[model samples]
Target: MFFVYKILIINILYYWHNDCFTCIGNINLYHMRTIKLLFTTLTLAVLATACYTEVIIEDEYIDEPVLNVHALLKSHELWYVDINATSGNREVPFLQRAFTVSFVGETVFANNNIVGIGKTGNGFGLDVGYFNTANGRLQINHDVDGYWSLEVFMVDNNTIELYDSNSRTSYYLEGYQRNNFDYDMVFYDNIEYLLQEYDVWEKVTTSKEGLLNDFDSENYLQFYIEGNRSMFNSSVDPSGMHLDDVLWDYSGEYSVFGVYNDETLKTLTLDYDFMGNDYFELYVINDSTIELYHSSSGTVYKFKGKGFISYLKSGISQLDKKRTKTEYGTMKVVRKRKI
Candidate 1:
């Protein structure tokens, strides 16, 4: 259009100049200059309009469909709270401890325990509170934690950000369904809680080839969290005895060390107050069983998890709660010893 206008203006000036010279015989220099100036101004105006119209067309934007925050909250069966990805100086205690949270109607559910994590509430855990969504915000009325209001920001189709204004913190959550979620990762990541899930681990099998040791007499084991310490109890009581009826022979602190590069393997050290520390390589046979290889004795003992203890009704133990607040990567790592 600019090119067309320039061509048209040139033709008009050519014809006008010819006509003025022919009709006036000798046109004044001032009149000729004035006519040229008027034509130049008109051409510039047309070019400016063309440029302005192009910019308007380029700047035009297509409207995106606004996300329905309420619907999104209920879309996924579970929202795994990515604690490590959280931002801000202050932490929200409930969110910090929760492995996963879910929204169903007006109720909010959270999987705070790693034990039976994939199976509890069909992977949604327990109903901790009630929640309402409005104006892209989530207001939660927790049964134990009280009330909280957070601005909901959708990060993606499967991710969301819950930003707390009062704390100036943002928590990132990833959405997943029960069937597709990686429950094994959760178990390995929080294996400490898994050990505490059972009332007792009864010795079911023992390899005969290993050398005799003090652990050979032990038939039952229990791991528990008290205050800020990870503690354990061992008993020589019969395997079929009830948890409360069994006599615990030794009680002491314990620590689980992660393998350097292996996620499936771990080392456990039971600090026996009288006999000294006993070290074993630990392996999970299934959700309800674990195998411990005593490095010193060369014995492989398999323990079956008995009497499941869910943390849902009574709330999580202090040690488990403290572990949740800390970074998982900071766990102690030990190099696997070659047999």
Candidate 2:
């Protein structure tokens, strides 16, 4: 059947092309135009179905960045500077290193252009950082916590111009997220009946940390307070270093109480005492960690304790601005727990 149809179509084309119905000179102008139109239509139909194309579209999503500045000044180490740029250019390797990191004291961030130093002695621009120094040669030793402001000047090799100073950045060397909890605990309340349901918290490991991210303990320090009785334990030494202590105590004497700031922000105020009464602003990090922020003396204590199913609900992972992260000393609470 298919071969019969093919033969019929071929005969029809042959008859039309050979002018079996219309001769070349005798054919009407309209008739010739009509045949040409049909031929064009057939050619178009075959061409349309003969080719295929696959169009590919590429797309990407970029999140808006949160710009911040960080500078950690250690006692006998180089000061590491990080200027965080969310959307703009981050680190340019072609720029030269910082020529000077002057001691602008505590008010340098606000002082604006207090000190100035450009590139030195025809040196090529590459990488720039701050070392713990005072007069360009003498090493400066200082115990700086919380946020300290500084000024930086970089000569861009691309444009041969000074880097933009308008990128107002803050130096928050403090590692732990500040005030990481939403719920408060009361040690001397009628909730003492609930206290019996909870176990006493103790230190988990015997190691000190230079940074909150450096906290690597098989057991994290734990603390609990019900009524006027509070107990705490840690394995941190006086030098703020982690160690294996067979004499570490899990429970100590202390009572704590706390309150929620408001329903809007839900800030927790936990007040407790061991040898002396002290309070902390709580910030929650996750199910296993929280930070204790002391605003007065600029101190931060990061504690990781699991099993607080009731209190560990909301997890705010971002670092707080008020918390001191560059704690050169050991965990303050554990160091105080040395009694």
Which candidate's TM-score is highest? 1
In the predicted model 1, the residue pairs found to clash are none
Q: Candidate 2: how many backbone clashes?
A: 27
Residues 72-103, candidate 1, lDDT per residue (tens digit)? Answer: 89888889988778899887777987889999
User: Per model, how many backbone clashes are there?
Assistant: 0, 27
TM-score for each candidate, following the candidate numbering: 0.69, 0.22
lDDT (tens digit, per residue) of candidate 2 on 123-177: 1112222233232222322222222223322222111112323343233121111
lDDT of 2: 0.30
